[model samples]
Structure formats: structure tokens, C-alpha cells
Target: MNIVRIPFSILLLLLTTSCQPKNKSDKPETPQIVKETVAPKVEISLEELQNYETAYFASGCFWCVEAIFESVKGVKEVFSGYSGGTEKDPTYEQVAYGRTHHAEAVEVYYDPGVISFTELVQVFFGSHDPTTLNRQGPDRGAQYRSIAFYKNEKQKKIIISYIAQLESKNIYGRPIVTEVSEFEIFYKAEEYHQDYEKRNPNNSYIRNVSIPRLNRFKKNFKSYLKEDSH
Candidate 1:
């Protein structure tokens, strides 16, 4: 069982043998090579998160929005947080004031091998209103504005095209005002709000708004649902 004596080159080969396609083109592409400049890390964990990608949205309360996307199958994880903010590591109360420019957002982690950025973009457009200027449902304020934080140029391009498509279809019957910008940082929500819906399903907000949003996403994207997923 002592595998330490085995050549490292063999281990390297085994690690790289299972790479998958990443872009729209069918051409064989190495994700590491293409994404290397896009916040790619020097080392990947044993969990195969190397294949995972992230996208952020700020349609409304992080609680409802986080619960919605977590039901998605290819989606690996959803973290409620603040994004597009001016403050550094702004707290729940600070962002609630809307003075920091931070919006209640969800940072979604997903396996790009199972889902494409375009598909994730589609999921985003479907889950929330891109037409809303600074509000979603009952949550009305600049802090509730819609945003799509892109980590790389590839993601930015996909978001742009998707917005264009929505505009052509008159999806929201107005210009898609979703903010698409380079992802700067994500400040995770308070511990109590991390998995608020799952842990506090009986809570008022979770029971009402969050639960409905979660159920809607599951029903609409049933095929993307996973076992013990969220």
C-alpha cells in the first residue's frame, strides 16, 4: 500500500486523464490552460473542484435567492453573501442599509463539466427578473438590484450574449439592466444565514418567500435536481 515510491509522473498522468471540454467550440481544450489566467489556482483539491465554476447574482434577499439556486443539480454550492459593494467585508447590517452598494447576493458553485456557463446564465435569467432596476418582489432598494459577477472574460461574454438574447425576446418587456462586471470579492453572510432555508425552514421568511422560490426552481428544473443535493 506504500504508493510513495510510485513515480510522480504517473500520478500526474492519472490526474490529467479525465479533463472535460469547457467552451462552446468542440475543439479539445484544457480547462487549466484556458482558465489558468482566470483566477485558476496552482493546485486543486482531491474533491475535483477543479471542474467547478462560480457565478454570482443579487436579485433579492440572499435567503430566497440562495435557496432557489441550491436546488439546481449541476450547482455544487450556494453561499449567501454581499457583492458589488464598496465596503470591505461589510456586515449584514451595513449592507442592509444599502450605503455600501452591496446587494444581498448568492455565490453559486457548480461543476462546469456538467453545466455550461451559458446554461448557468440561463438559470440565472430564469430564476429572477433581469428587468428589475433596484428591487425584487417585496425587497425594494438599491441593495436588492440584480447583478452578474463574472470571474473571467469567457463568463462575461456569455452573460452579455444572454442579456442580448433576452432583450431581443423582450423577456422582461424592458432593457435587461443586470449588472455584468468583473468579480472582485464575495463576503459570506453571517453564520446563521449561510444555509438559512435548510436550517430554519420554519422561520417566517424561509417558510414564506424562500420555500416558494426553492420549490419553483425544483419544479421548473426537475432534471437538474440531485439527491441530498442542497
Candidate 2:
């Protein structure tokens, strides 16, 4: 993430504060927070990104997972998609019915140079309640199920170690039921769903749940969050 400077925003805020003193509402009328500008990610060739790695997890709404992964420093992209199902290229509507066998998951594309797969797993554990089986918060059913889609033997070991560490530390009163499986199918979601939280911030679900989730994560992992993701 790269910071963006806009003098107009400062000008607008000054004008609003000085020009409209009549309405003395408790909440001040303020301009929206300006976000940082990031250059479009040049699509990485499969061979180049291989130096990094891929990981996946399903812990609730894809919007939340996508937002969480994007906060991690090493992560290149977090895609909202469906996986661990037999279906092929399932549509959002089809998956919503809970018949696709897919768990709404986020695929993390990250650079190993900036963060390790082990740390990514830690972020996964921190971002969502792993004890909730087949659910995260209020959302229920298989689509919102928790699962760790491991790409290889290394990821399996990393996931196992993290779970054991959490269990030994008594992190939660209940047992963790997150599924650990070898990755197979991954169906990219619809185009608009790529960055649901960032793209549709005004939508009811995105605004109420997704943004709050992202904000909480930002507070927790201030160091890991991408500089511009804030």
C-alpha cells in the first residue's frame, strides 16, 4: 500500500468546518478518510511467484477472509473463492444454496521473502474463531465452514504445529474443529467478488460485517498490514 496525498481533501474539510457552523450536531461532519493509492499488481507469472507460495483457508464469509489476508504484509493478493468441493466453477447463487460442497474460502498469494507460511497460519488463527465448526460468527452452513486447504506437505506441518501450540496454550475453552486437508479444487469467484470488502464498502453486509472485521484486524496486526491497505 502506498500513501496518496490530496490537497483538495484538506481544502474541503476546512471549507466544511468554517462554512457550516450552524448545524451543531454531536458528530462532526467530516470528509471520508482518504485511502492510500497502490499501483496495480503486475500479474505475477506462475514461475516467479513459485519462490513465494500459496495457501488457503475457509472461516466464514469470503469477504472477511479476503480482508484478513490482504492485511498481512507478505501477501500479494487475497482472492474470495470456493474450494474443497467437487463442483466446477460454481456460481455465487449455486453456492449460496449450500449444495456445491464448497466452503467459501480465500486463497492467499504471498511472498515468502516478506512473511513465512507459518506466520500466515498465525494470521489465519488470529483473524477468526477456529473453535466454531462450519461457522464464523452468525453465518452458518457448509459455505461458512472452517477449513485449511494445504497445498503440500510443508503447509500440513506448519498448520499442525500452529494448532498444537494453540491447544497447549489453552487459547480457547473449546476444541478447534478447523479442517486440514490437501488442496484440490479452487473456483475463482465472480469478477466483482475479487476484493469484496474493498470494492463494495457501502453494501450492507460489507459495511456492517466486513469492514469491522478488517478494522479489528488492522488494530491487532498493525505491523503486518500492508502500508496502503489501511
In TM-score terms, which candidate is top? 2
Residue 75 lDDT (model 1): 80
In terms of lDDT, model 2 sits at: 0.70
lDDT of 1 by residue, 137-217 (tens): 556678888898888898888888777767766656668788887888889876666666666655555555656666666
Top model number, lDDT: 2
For 71-171, candidate 2 gives per-residue lDDT tens digits of 78989777778997998888766665575899888888889889888778877777777887776765667788788878889889888878877777667
List clashing residue pairs in candidate 2.
Answer: 1-228
Alpha-carbon TM-score of each model against the true structure: 0.74, 0.77
Estimate every model's Cα lDDT from 0 to 1.
Answer: 0.67, 0.70
User: How many angstroms is residue 101 displaced in model 1 relative to the true structure, after the best TM-score fit?
Assistant: 1.0
Q: How close is candidate 1 to the true structure, as a TM-score?
A: 0.74
Error of 2 at 178 (Å): 0.2
